[model samples]
Target chain A: MTRSVPVRVHRDLARAITAIENGYASFGDTLATLPARENGKASFVVGVTGPPGAGKSTLVDRLIEKFRAGGETVAVIAVDPSSPFTHGAVLGDRVRMQRHSGDTGVFIRSMASRESGGGLAPTTHDATALAAHAGFDVILVETVGVGQVELEIVAVADVVAVVTVPALGDSVQTIKAGLTEIADLFVVNMADRPGASRTALDLKHMVRESGRDVAVLQTIASEGTGIDDVMVALTAARASESSNAGRAVRFEVVRNIRDAAVRRALAVLDAPRGRSVLERLRAGELTRLEAREELLVYALAEVINAD
Target chain B: MPIKVLVAKPGLDGHDRGAKIVARALRDAGMEVVYTGLHQTPEMIVTAAVQEDVDVIGVSILSGAHMTVFPRIMKLLEERGVDDICVIGGGVIQENDVPKLKVLGVREIFDADATTQNLIDGIERVVAEFGRARKRTGAATPAS
Candidate 1:
């Protein structure tokens, strides 16, 4: 049996990681609880996303070197919604991170997002914390293909980078509309390809039309070009977040603690009264409104008991 | 409580279709699934399995890294003293790896294209056996 532990201790970190992975955090708002020891660990979560063949894995490879050279531990989470189709990525992320395998400071994980919205909820989020809890200073999540659900990553990250290739056709409505806003920085990869410059220019025009302050970068990825500038954009964003001083992260942390407590109360709980009402509903002994009342009482009791 | 599972991606393999599908079907079946996101090492996974206290540890691997990663996880679990937990697998595993895996004590192997129903039924059955084994050891006994 696994005994519970304090969430801030190193040994207990695994237990906390498990709690998050298991959907214990999902039934309520427990996702925001600050560790008992805030001083213990922290990481910059950077999300990089774009369509397939945009050289995200390769960009990540170069980024690792830039971070490691400064003596920072880097954790990479690459989400792939298409497994067999991604054909080479299972090997690519690994091969790219291989040089650091011996360094002990780099941990890279690739996930197939097959379930609804890419099934990234439990896996990628838990993995990020596992890295932060393991003491990494930087974590990168390379989103699987952009989908309706990939938007969930925004909840877990501090900075969002939307990666795209040169000459994306006008047919991509979602990319042009949905992605352009959330992106703090944009990278036009495969810069050597024809029409790459034109695509960047067109994207810039499209973005400018929207009147947003997004940084656009161009990269030839294979030769390790233009990544440093991307890093500069990322760092600037993080620095701004900390200095903004609204303390939104603090509020989130507090909210999560309360939510976790409520959820735990919901579990290990017995609503004999609610069950009896439900049983009445099943037996047609009570109207739906009556059942609703019983449920409301149960929900209130849960919050009270949780405290 | 429904059977709880921890589906983990260990190593560098990025393919997760099977893992995600299994997670969804299991959740739909009323199972509680705790997914340990990708790039898990044997150490991280064992630590997760123990903490989640799942009835089974189902790892979906296609990276050819399974031969090395799986055994490492098995050994890590044994060391952690949760060897009683059932281990099952899927993905493009070679037929030859099956026998060795069974020797390592995996209960069942589901090949590709196995229906979602197949995985669900297999997990339910394994969970039942797991409960029985726990009872035999007097680790936990049900009200019935």
Candidate 2:
């Protein structure tokens, strides 16, 4: 069992997160040393994802309030997209949650989704783990505004709430196949607007046909209406002892191994021997397949030598 | 790693046109800018800066509250024991108040005449300086 020294200082936690984000040399060791939950229950990671302007941030802010009122510390990681051209981002999600800034019980960090396609920053998982290790009872992860197929939240959160709005022009937009599969619950925010009931009913029908026990709840998040139901549903989903935690761990391990191997392969291809193979291929002395095989052999040799 | 900046609008000023422009310029210059929308108190700004672990904070004040805002933000950062994150100011201000604000640890202040490129260049300089100082002092490293 790793010794648990909860990082209580805001500045220290912030620094650790920054280190992790920057991929510092010692960050892997730091993550390894973080204490796991003693009770064997997974940390409560709530992932709120939705289309842009669906009131995800407002809902998260309300959820933070609910969690804080129950004497639970919460850490929110809000993600925004980085401009592909400039590789920069304007993270504005914290605007809605600024009310909780003065509260020591709440910590909010905004991240830019840099070179990641799954609606999250690459370091989101590590940051969530750090926040959990730091003794926050609830870790809320808000993904960048996503379209269908940005279902990476499934690998991080114990409970995934997909928030949407009414009159998105077509009810079919709500039932996108990729998003429906990952949702533990669906929230129709701006429920006070017209067609709220229609959207909720469409989601309910879809959920019924899918035969998953996903709850569809409606909320006017700005007014805090129906948020209690969301809280209740989230609590119930968490308490049901789902396999999400184990699945997330397995997914992370597999992803890490794949990423490391890819990095090693790239390193091998960048070395002198591999460069020679590439030069030969360019000169038509070797075929593309032959060059690929040679590179793979070099990568394997590098890996074996390291061992 | 990209530089992370917090573009905060402090005080009761609802006119955030300038703040938004600055934020856009910073983003275009390849900086990750966190925008805290209108009416942020010093406590809120400091809290956000500490939590985000930003390289610098650019506070935009049009309410003529620089004297009140800059000192409180500086003091809050000091109170929180965060010295490495540089604090900067921009927006409307009397020319005389700029020196006084700088005396309170506001690193640089831009008035109406300063262009976005000037602001970006100024921030890059300050961030580079702070990064060097943190490297020398190891102030940004987490304690084991």
Candidate 3:
């Protein structure tokens, strides 16, 4: 593997991330060459996620200020949804954080969630790892506006802050399964709105009932109000042993294995030998399930033989 | 795998209608467009381009600061030792200043008469040129 770019250089770090985003053939080698964290202190990754129009970006912008003021080098990975049809995206998350553009202590990258259903771009993990390797003390990952089940943030961040706004109608929206389970802290951003206290209270009550130690903080992110408390809560959350630590590694390994298997299976299906099974199915000589099993067998054989 | 372009409105121009339209058109044409909203400084724009590692930057300057803005951006990119990212300009520029801006290493200047298709085609062309340059020197070497 050729390691041409120095991973610690800012310019080279940007290039390394681009290589990962574009799936350059040797990007893994570049990542592999990055020095491991010293003293077991890797960059702290904070995942900020919420529904559309929840001010996730605005809150992230404020948090970036708070983190930077503490003198930590911060890197942000903001992901936006790609058009399922065109695979293109208009990444506007940086508009709110544009003030930090010239600040050398900050590095922000926008990514389009192409073919990744997880609210994050496919290469977000790789990019975050590269940023950590580049020696950032904090990495803030802002996911695409999410709904109930974009729980992939749990697999990446040391702390997951789920930002929600007030007057979301039914308070039941707050207790939904996937999001509530993953949140280490809940931020009622845009807290100046009408139902701010009520929303916060509901969340607090829900957390109490669930017997979880989750902290709920309120903030009008646009005004930079209540941000300090939110930051404090985040610090506390980070101090706690994350339940996702072991699960995250296992999740990544499983995902990688799944991706590789899918690739190999596709390769087998595209080849003549595997296509014959499809032909048999098409000719009514084999059932769909039978053909699928035959293809899986071929794919498994290919995977085993390659070893 | 996709072409990434940064569309920014630099200077005091509040007129982002043109910039937004171009960004939307680019996105619809299968390009990832980063729209950095209004009144961005040249420094901010370049910082964004470098951090985003965008293949091209489309600066929309209707503030008549083209003479000041284009040169500053070009100089900044040069100072940063970044040549791979292409810079293009659009919106309310006098026809006579087109060649002048191009001389400053602005890849292409699209005026009012230039349609969305023209802008898109021009961007794709310049991005392809940069891609070829990168290929020739190897991807690790910055395109000179």
How many clashing pairs per prediction, in order?
Answer: 3, 0, 0
lDDT of 1 at A283: 100
Q: Candidate 3 — which residues are off by over 4 angstroms? A: A1-8, A32-40, A169-171, A273-298, B132-144
Overall local distance difference test of candidate 1: 0.64
Compute DockQ for each candidate against the true complex: 0.09, 0.57, 0.52
Which scores higher on lDDT, 1 or 3?
Answer: 3
Best by TM-score: 3
**What docking class should model 3 receive?**
medium
lDDT of 3 by residue, B2-98 (tens): 7999998887875688888998999999999999899899999888888888889898888788999999999988887677889999888999999
Taking all chains together, each candidate's TM-score versus the true structure is 0.54, 0.88, 0.90
Per-residue lDDT of A256 in model 1 = 58
Write the candidate numbers in order of decreasing DockQ. Answer: 2, 3, 1
- Candidate 2 chain B: worst-modelled 10 consecutive residues by lDDT: B132-141
List the lowest-lDDT window of 10 residues for candidate 3 chain A.
Answer: A1-10
Measured on C-alpha atoms, candidate 2 has an lDDT of 0.85
**A162-274 per-residue lDDT for model 2 (tens digits):** 99998875657656678777888999999999999998998899899878899999999999999999999998987898857776777678667666667788998788897
Cα deviation of A59 in candidate 2 (Å)? 0.8
Report the Cα RMSD per candidate. 9.7, 4.1, 4.3
Docking class of 1: incorrect
Docking class of 2: medium
lDDT of 3 by residue, A1-307 (tens): 1112232356667777777677663556656545554535678899999998899999999988988888787889999999999988999999999888767888888999998888998889888988887778899999999988887887789888999898885668767788888888899888878999999999998899899888999988899999999889888767777766886887678777777788889999899988898899999999989988888898999989998
Q: Tell me the spans in candidate 2 whose CA falls farther than 4 Å from its real position.
A: A1-8, A28-42, A169-176, A272-307, B132-144
